[model samples]
Target: MEKQFTLRKNEDFKRVYKKSKHYYNRDFTVLVKNNGVNRPRIGFSISKKVGKAHQRNKLKRRLRSIVYNNYRYINNVDIIIIPKKHTTDFTYDKLKSSLGHVLNKAFKEKKINYVK
Candidate 1:
């Protein structure tokens, strides 16, 4: 993901965590907050409990790829994605579908709006 579309600061993540509405699925918990920007931004929070460093990095990469591919569907929100322990067992397709399901649900509920 581009730097401009990724949340890089601790404060930014904290703000989303504190003020955002949440959406969940078996593999991930997503926090969504209106950013009032022209584009969406995303952050990942993979804990040590999820796995070793390399595993966490791999998960982040996969998620970034998924978000990049689906960027056009997301609106102007700041999102923090927290992967559950079960995610370590997921293949890329599985993870992508799981995240997509939660995002679709969020959009349907109007918790997060979808762009064209």
Candidate 2:
């Protein structure tokens, strides 16, 4: 992903939270919205309620990996993945599954095309 396309500030998160389309699954939340920009972007928020610093970092790593792995093939949407408390103990497979599953559900609900 391009550096400039990333969502990085408190205000950006607030905007997405307020204005974006959101979807949720048992273990993940996927928020997406068209910002009318030409590029796709991403950000992550793993809360302290999920665990201590180590667990939070782990969750971020999981999300970053999943996003990077799939970023190239996705459409130009701004994505923010918020990991809930249940996400802390997730394995790689679980994380991938949760992300993919929830994102697909979200896409379906919004009628967004996701090329496999």
Q: Pick the candidate with the highest lDDT.
A: 1
lDDT of 2 by residue, 6-116 (tens): 799888888888898889988888899877777778888777799999888877877787777677656667889887897788898888887888788867855743423
Candidate 1 at 34: error in angstroms?
0.2
lDDT of 2: 0.78
Candidate 2 stretches with Cα past 4 Å from truth are 109-116
Per-model CA lDDT versus the true structure: 0.85, 0.78
Q: How big is the positional error of residue 63 in model 2, measured in Å on the Cα after superposition?
A: 1.0
CA RMSD per model (angstroms): 2.4, 2.2
Candidate 1 local lDDT, residue 73 = 73
Tens digits of lDDT, candidate 1, 9-87: 9999989999999998878898999999999899999999999988999998998898898886766889888999879
Candidate with the greatest TM-score versus the true structure? 1
Backbone clashes in model 2, listed as residue pairs: none
- Provide backbone clash counts, one per model: 0, 0
